[model samples]
Target: MEVPPSPTFPRALPSRSIPLAILSFLLVGVISLVILPHDFRLQEMFPSSCTNGAAASTSGQLADAATQPVVDLRVFLGVLTRPGMYERRAHLRLAYSLQPRPVRAVIDVRYVFCNLDKEEDRVLVAMEIIAHGDIVVLNCTENMDGGKTYECSPTSPTTTSARPTTDTYYRLAALADTLRDKPRDGLYHGFLNPCHQSRETQYMSGMGYIVSWDIAAWISAREELRHERGYEDSLFGWWMRKGGFKNVYGEEPRMYDYLDREMGEGVTCFRHELIADTVAVHKLKDRLKWARTLNFFNVTQGLKPSKMYDVDRLNSNMYHV
Candidate 1:
């Protein structure tokens, strides 16, 4: 029932050489991410080397993806929004924030926003900031790209020699940060596209990506790594290859891109493609689309209506409820 390792993953790199004893234990789970909170000290929390990158595979227990334990995933869900998109922001807080946590993972939601140009708007934003302590307002102008700054929020690994910078990634109190203490024995970094790239060594959807605490720490802590790659996910991948770290890419189908469309073989349904426990979905630009997606997962498990009709009860039900 083992998921065959990606061609790039099975062979060990000289830079990332591991003792076979350790390697044997490392190959347990599929693609996953484990990030810790700022309040917890990294070394003290996860003192073992296994958490650095190598982790025992959680998927090996079952041959099929459906039967596997919902591996413990702690995600710092950072939703980026602009000033005028108040409705979109509200929908995120209401739907995504309210999403019932999966039995296998823990997810925390936070919105990353930039300063508003209109001075009059501050009054309204201030109220929102007060109501929900989740908003992170950067000093820079509000724009789509400002979300990139959230990458700066993670605490870096003390083991790395990456240089530090004056940027406020450390000073921001980490409201912009995602995920908290991952499994102590292993690393679980998340990414929407857990697949091999064509021209690029790593191809990841900026929307969602996962990594062990060490990888995120390496990127967030080091000031020099800030501008290394074009996108946040790519930058992390660049460092992985450059740093001689192993890439434990998981199954790509786990993260769906087709929101309401049919894909792959003969599956048919509006959001049937988005089955239960999809790690992440990308390119959700509109508020309504987000609502629909959330409703699909929460309200309608899939388009299939069975004889026993009550979706809440079904052998195929993937949800914990």
Candidate 2:
């Protein structure tokens, strides 16, 4: 069969139309510049999602809202735990509930664990999930020193707190303020291992750590981390080093372990007595540690005068689990 050649149109625009075309292009560009925003922003793109009607009711308030950049950062703090630790969860819930909510930021506390094995866990955990709806079940078996943390990375939670390893009995407001200044991407904020060194090998302690959302996303995208063994924190450090990510180590008396007076007054870089400005306290292995830590923070200061009984007599240090 004979094939017909397609008609060839002019490759260039007409000589006379060139000036008109350029004028039209410039007009369109100017119109676009006038119509479009000077800067792209979440609020400008999706005003309804960014601002609540109640929040920006007044014209002045709305104007202020329009001027201000909307931050979409949410801190997902997941506490890794066994599904059977109902009492511990309850305690944690109480501890978190007592904290003042962060301003202009969401701090969601999620209980993370592997699949439920025991019948008690299945039942109680399901109940807890129904009541709270803040539990995360990873696709792995329950075991410490396993790749559970690696498994959790895909979930892309932001930070950790109020777990068995540490007692975060500090002001959430202060934390929120601190977090505001934190780098949005490529940051690992916590007490780094080998506090004296700023090397790549240094890993944030498992006691608690904070990874920005971008870092979490980067971690989730890597498949090699799934099979990596050894300490989860160390593996995370390795991964960060592999990716050339940055670490923001919280230094000295600011971020330290809970100093057991009974364990002697010997102090190191990471472990020391509680100070006025503590970001975190690690090694809260027992109820006594938590009690002492909480007491030190004056968590019970709001307790009103009661005729029932005096809370003053109850020594928090005496309570041990």
Candidate 3:
């Protein structure tokens, strides 16, 4: 069999012109590279511009009263924390970020920490501060016996307390109700220490507590508090006593510890199973506890339905199990 003449196609670039075209393309690329900004970096070219601010939405996101209705009050809720507990802080951020904003109120959540001793923390924490704009770096050494919480007073007219793993999960609505009912100065609201001397002399437990702006300002004013050496909470109580500020409000079972079912043998007044209408739950201590606590509140209730997920099953397995 004889083959017919094959079809021929013209070349887009002739062989003679190919080298010149290649050289021109190469030159253009080189010129483009050279003409780029001297300090041109990928980060600068495609910068991640993250604006940190409270969003105004009832969709379980962090929000302030700025974009809402008339503001009745502003509460600075500072979480006393350490530089090393990054995971704990992340959990807390998620926990609070998913909470509904209190009506006519602003609950500014800030992470309060002592001086950064570690090099990694200095870098990482700085990044966090820049990213979140919700960190308070105190100028004292970190220690429970030291005046870390005391130092947080002068920083802001804020309520300083710890969070899960010494963290607290509280209902903002319940707290607002409590405060609205007792709108007065010299307010020291917390779980009263059970073994304390009397109602008049008793101190709030260290799990968590809240001091009104007046009480915090009073503590901040006393330069002598800087020299005091004792348990932070106990010292705070002593100061309350010294100042004769007797507007102490105790929330015993209302604000108690996370009750582990296995270790439910001997629960104290401040340690037991969770309850509805809770002002706060303490001793969340780990991720599992936090999961349970968050699940109890139905934090994910507003999540849009999707066939891509079986969140109910995931929740039951992840938390309930």
Give the whole-model CA lDDT for all candidates, comma-separated. 0.38, 0.49, 0.53
Q: Candidate 3 lDDT, tens digit per residue, 105-185?
A: 545555666789999999999898667666667665655433333343223332222222335676766765665555344
What does each candidate score in C-alpha RMSD? 13.5, 16.9, 27.1
The lowest-lDDT stretch of 10 consecutive residues in candidate 3 is 20-29
Best by lDDT: 3
Cα lDDT over the full model 1: 0.38
TM of each candidate vs. truth: 0.54, 0.69, 0.72
lDDT of 2 at 112: 64
Model 2, position 93, has a per-residue lDDT of: 70
Candidate 1 regions off by >4 Å? 1-34, 37-75, 104-106, 139-200, 229-232, 259-272, 300-321
Give the Å error, residue 41, model 2. 17
Name the candidate, 1 or 3, with the larger TM-score value. Answer: 3
Regions more than 4 Å wrong, model 3: 1-69, 144-165, 195-197, 318-321
Error of 3 at 111 (Å): 0.3
Collision pairs in model 2:
none
TM-score of candidate 2 on Cα atoms, chains taken together: 0.69
Give the 10-residue window scoring lowest on summed lDDT in candidate 1. 19-28
